[model samples]
Target chain A: MTEHTLAEHTLTATDLRLAYDRREVVHGLSVAVPPGKMTMIVGPNACGKSTLLRGLARLLAPVGGTVELDGRDISTIPGREVATVLGILPQSPAAPEGITVADLVGRGRYPHQGWFRRWTAQDDAAVNEALTATDTIELAARPVAELSGGQRQRVWIAMALAQRTDLLLLDEPTTYLDVAHQVEVLDLLVDLNVTSGTTIVVVLHDLNLACRYADHLIAMRDGAILAEGAPADVVTTDVIERVFGMRSRIIPDPLSGTPMVVPESRHRMENSA
Target chain B: MTAHAVVAGVRRRARLTTLVLAVLAAALLLLALSVGTAVVSLPDVLSTLAGQGSRATDYIVLERRLPRAMTALLVGAAFGLSGAVLQSLLGNPLASPDVIGISAGAGASAVTAIVVFGAAGPPVALAALLGALLTAALMYVLAWRDGVTGYRLVLVGIGLAAILLSVTSYFMTRSQVTSAQDALVWLTGSLNESGLDELVPLAIALTILVPATAISARALDLLAFGDDTASGLGVEVRRTRLALLVCAVALAGTATAAAGPIAFVALLSAPIGRRLARDGGPALLPSALTGAVIVAAADFAAQHAPGLPQVPVGVLTGAIGAPYLLFLLARMNRGGHGG
Candidate 1:
């Protein structure tokens, strides 16, 4: 695994349970995400990984427990107050029709404005900073719909960054992107964490990339944590087979030396079974 | 140039466009006031406005023309702002008061008041307000089964509006021809001269409602970002939406009650405002002003049209607005896929 360091605020949970339409999605789950670190929550489809992320982001209310953002109950805080501290970028945020990149990014400053307040120099600076940080400065005035998948994803990241919150939660930010674009977004997230000390909590499906890039890895199965710790210490062949319910060959990533999982499919499964 | 200079330039350009539109609207209002069938000259119109004209000029100006002009201004601005706000909020260009049922609701209720109680003496405005509010409330409840999706709300509103419209037609068929003729103006969205007494209240209502809406323009900008994002950005999504809806209903309802469903003011003004503003930003204030200009101008045109008996200002607006609505629909269909 690559060398990594954990940063400080304690994002903790207690007896956190989540449900939809009276059916439980996430069981009693508890975990602490240290501040200023990249934590990736990973699992297969229907494993409640996204549900858990939504619960943590306060988009989904917990059925039985509370998520604590620095010791205070998150739900108890005013919505805007919570927004000022934490920003969540949901998967597939619907863009308003005919909206431009600059206008869309400017919306991220909503929490900072008042009824009478026009966009200030500070707001512009933050918007420009976000655009440059995500390398979308050149496309600032272009309509968001015209951007490629990768560029659009970057524009969304720029929007979230414009919020300027301490903690950023992204649910499958890399979805619908090509592998190259996926790496670019992940690298951008890594750069944000490393440079600005913004705590990044991401829900990613790719186990190998999760292991390679995340400072902390959280492997979940059936809405409960199967493993959580430093990636090198937590990701292993046994953890993969047990948590993922698959037979896999765990090898080092060719570039990063992080543990890479090569799933044994139907052809290989015949001999193993 | 610095970034501030760039932003300033954009703002100044927008301001200039607004100023030009304002001048055009004012010229239209003056022309509307002066050049009617009575054909009062500009000097006579000016003297009448200053309250110092011949008795005949005074009667034409104060008794007939002034009330109609003022009604047009109020109704137009109200319609335009409401349409713009609704369109932006729902992210649909077709989401005008009539299409979404606000005016239909008002029309239906006014017809009911006339048919059932034979309600007279300004009761139409009250009935219209009640109907409009009820429809808005119904639409709100139906669209909120989960969260208010823009498409769901518009669809529900259109359906509800259609139902109210059929009920209105049914009532018309059953009523006496004289009653039907009386109701016809309100039903088709007319501006009869009798509703002038409703003007003071309408003006007062606009004064309160328009400013309140202007204050929430920023929140509306956030709301157009979609509910979750808007909420995440510190907007109380439900509350802000409710507030805006209240303002829109009150503005449209009051104006409709006073002028009997003045057509296209709410539907056409906001979009026209958006185009005139030209920055493509949500042009709330300018939309309101444009609405006023359109209503005033249409009323003028109705009074001045030669070889035809004067139609309700509503008739002329409908004649104009219906085509624009159809044009928009045709344009949408040609695109093969649209909202």
Candidate 2:
């Protein structure tokens, strides 16, 4: 594979407002993603964490303010140009029936190619590397329809990796996976970040996993950021109560040195007593 | 089982399928040309096509069957390409032009022109083209909530198709018996009166639209992943869809104008092509070739099948395709993926 030069990318949203029809989903939110770091957005259901990710990926146009990439308004850049710099994997993308994993991953080369450019060896190398990185090289020849849920998710991540972009955004990449597979997926992302210095942002539902994997943490509620900082600083009992509307005890994870939330529920309290 | 090996295997299979389909289409075309009343031999057909044959052979091959055979090939290919494009664009195998009211729109308009306006030939074809375009626009408008989803588009198309079919039936009921009989033959999609005038316009349309379809094949493949994924992959989803829709309508319209919506060839060709190639992407060239082979073979069967009365090729295709469609619907209802 041709070694792609890593360009510095900065993604920031200012006063961003998003809506589906007339009903607003995300209202006037401003945040900047730390460059070359793994940032995780965590929030409860319907809090617009996915919507914020969509805005950053340019999948949804902001209703009020602007999202900027390196100080230029992102909406102004042509889609293909933006695509070469940023890669996104939506929450749940359907695979065409009967498509092999390699062929599906090769689609990530779309932005790097033109009508006449066709497929080249460089593309093949990129695809092969992505598959290898995701540990999906063994499943490359299998049809996507035949893969397990975890395998399919890895194949999708490999597709995004093949884009070879400086910035990658994933919306709930670990959903629908077993605990082992979820950690496996997150570990793959960490490897990518450490080796390639690719800036990564993911919207995650699992609070403990988010804390364990995030270099920078963002907690959100009602489409607004409640707290943002390192996991240790941001994962306080008060912040968790404010953000999730649930009282929780914060404890250090035995596996990782990050704060893990232990929710205080009636059933749990009764059992403990 | 390496990625390269798998990709190469698919490519090889697709190429082999294309070659096989091309040869089958050619053989069927020759059979259709040679096996009519006053049965000419293959040699005579070839000589006549090369511009040196007996007067009888020349009149039989060049003046009569060649135009019909060529019309079958071109119109069928056009329909196939259009169907493949639509199916991939909407991410539903059921989104063929015939099912989604494009051909119905053309058929409705052409029937109206023939019955109400007493129109024949080129004017009817022009009417069909306009009708198909208008119906596509209307379907897009009706299906658009925020954006057109495959499910909504197919549902809206089926509704429009029902309305157009009723309009066509009403027009037939109002026309004179003789005029209605003429419209009936056209409606059943016979290759009986296929001539150079009809063939040339469809040929021109295919020449332009076929290349356009080829160019958009990659985008169509990406679109199967849904609009958000496709857009994230750098496909200009809306623009690509609009361009593809226009191409699909023009192709289906031109084919309908020529042969009155030869039933289900478009609907059947892509899936068959995909199966033959064993590839997941939109098999444009393979589908087109498969369609040509199907129509040419169907026309031959319609003309020469023993103990069967003379019938339009459309009747045979519809008889064959409708059962398959039902089977598909049953499977989908039983929890198979419909889209």
Candidate 2: give the clashing pairs.
none
Superposed model 1: Cα runs more than 4 Å off: A1-10, A268-273, B1-13, B37-63, B194-196, B278-281, B331-338
Off by over 4 Å in 2: A1-3, A270-273, B38-40, B47-59, B336-339
* Model 2 chain A poorest ten-residue lDDT run: A1-10
Best by TM-score: 2
Return the clash pairs for model 1, or none.
B76-B291, B76-B292, B77-B291, B77-B292, B79-B266
Instruction: Give me candidate 2's TM-score against the actual structure.
Output: 0.95
Candidate 1, residues B1-339, lDDT tens digits: the string is 333344455567668767876787777766766776678888888888888999998888778777767777778888888888888877788888888999899999999898867885478789998899999999999888656877888899999999999999999999988888888866766555643687777888888998898887888877776676777776777777788888888888988888878877788888788876654467887888888887777776676767758778888888888999999889989998557
Error of 1 at A74 (Å): 2.2
Which candidate number has the best lDDT?
2
Q: Write the per-residue lDDT of candidate 2 for residues A1-273, one digit (tens) a residue.
A: 244455388899999999888689898999999988999999999999999999998889899999999899998888888898899999988998889998899889998998643777888889989999999999988899999999999999999999999899999998899999999999999999888888999999999999999999999989899899999999999999999999988889999989999999877486544
- Per-prediction interface RMSD in Å: 2.8, 1.5
